[model samples]
Target: MAKTVVQEFTKGLWAEIPPFRLVLGLCPTLAVTKSVDGGIGMGIATTFVLVCSNILISLLRNVIPKQVRIACFIVIIATFVTVVELLMQAFTYALFLQLGIFIPLIVVNCILLGRAEAFAFKNKLISSLADGLGIGIGYTLALAALAALREILGNGTFYNIPIFGPSFQPFTFMVQAPGAFICLGLMLAGMNMLGKK
Candidate 1:
């Protein structure tokens, strides 16, 4: 049982990592990754929603009618998203603004809904918790990594702290919209190559 729980958790890290392996949650993944702070912020918010909603949905899975399961999942997800938004607004208003619509949009993030319908709703509570944490952390890591690359190249900083010498010129293009797609494409290609091996 313990091994199974561990398996459920670890799978989200690499085997089914939302951004790279699964190619899920691209909206915020692309939009908010220009800086490490934005990436991490959005990731944590999504994680919070994912874990909370997963737990509630799992607890009520049997109670929900089959015909309305999808609707029920959305409602549950939206509730947690509102909580996250309010908390962020009160504490980290800047990040709250930085993340903006993406926070509320978490209600529609495929990772949450997909996990609800595919894993959480059918699984035991403990397994659902593990799945949520694993996936959430995986998503966080993906955002942080992508943000680090973009920030370091585009702004010559990591988390807004300078790393390169003053003489270094920032590659401004890396932080732009076109850069998001190119960088994501490159990362996807890399993941695919590694998967083949």
Candidate 2:
């Protein structure tokens, strides 16, 4: 039982990463990852929601009717997301502004819903928690990577710390929508290449 739980928990890192492997939450993955801070903030917010929703869903799995499961999960997720959104607004107002709609859209992040339906609905509490943590971290890491690339090239910084000297000219495209696509495509290609090796 312990071994099985470990395997389930570990699978989310690469086997079922929300963005790269499962391709679950792309909207915020692509939309708000223009800087490392933005991506990290989004990741943290999503993780909070995922962890809360997963635990609640697992605890109530036996009670929630199958027909209304999705609705129930959404309500649970929305509540947590609202909390994170409000917290960010009050404390990290700048980041809150940067994340904007993407923060509220956490309610729609397929990763949370997918886990609630696929894993939490059937798993034990400990197993469900592990799965949520693994997937949340994986999603966060992917966003951070994208954000790092964008920030370094577009803003000549990482997490707002200037890395490039005065001689370096920022690549304006890296901060744009097209740059997100480009960065994602390259990262996807890199992952595929690594898998082939």
Candidate 3:
């Protein structure tokens, strides 16, 4: 029983990673991944909201009316998102600027809502916490990886620190809109191939 719970907690680290295997919450994944800084900031913010909302939702799972459950979940999620937004804006103005609309948009992030409805709503508080943390970490890692790729290849830097030297010619397009889609798609393909192996 204890081992099973640990498995549930660890699954989201790779197996059910968001915007990769699960394919939820792509908006922030794509929007804030241009820079590693923005990616890390946004990822942590989303994780904070996700974990908070999941805990609340799991605790209130039975009290919430069936008809109004979605509304309740939204309220809980929005409340946490607001907290994250204000904290980010107050402490990390530059990253907040980079994340911009995506911060508030966390209220509607599918991963948060989906877990609230599908997992948290049905699980114990401990299980829900594990799920939220695992999924949140997965989301964060995905964003960071994508941001690192774009930052290194597209901008010739890692975390805004020069990496490739003066001779490196950045791809430039890797940071563009089309490039985001292409990069994510390629990554998804790579993941699929690895999963099959």
Show pairs that collide, candidate 1: none
Please provide, for model 1 over 83-105, each residue's C-alpha lDDT reduced to its tens digit, 9 standing for 90 to 100: 99999999999999988899999
Q: What is the C-alpha lDDT of each candidate?
A: 0.94, 0.90, 0.90
* Global lDDT of model 3: 0.90
Candidate 2 per-residue C-alpha lDDT over 1-197 given as tens digits, one digit per residue, 9 for 90 to 100: 88877887778778887777777898899998999999999999998899888998999989999999899999999999999999998999999999999999999888899899999999889999898988888889999999999989999999999998999999999999999999998988888898788
TM-score of each: 0.98, 0.96, 0.98
Off by over 4 Å in 2: none
The alpha-carbon lDDT assigned to residue 190 of candidate 2 equals 85
- The alpha-carbon deviation from the true structure for residue 67 of candidate 3, after best TM-score superposition, in angstroms, is 0.8
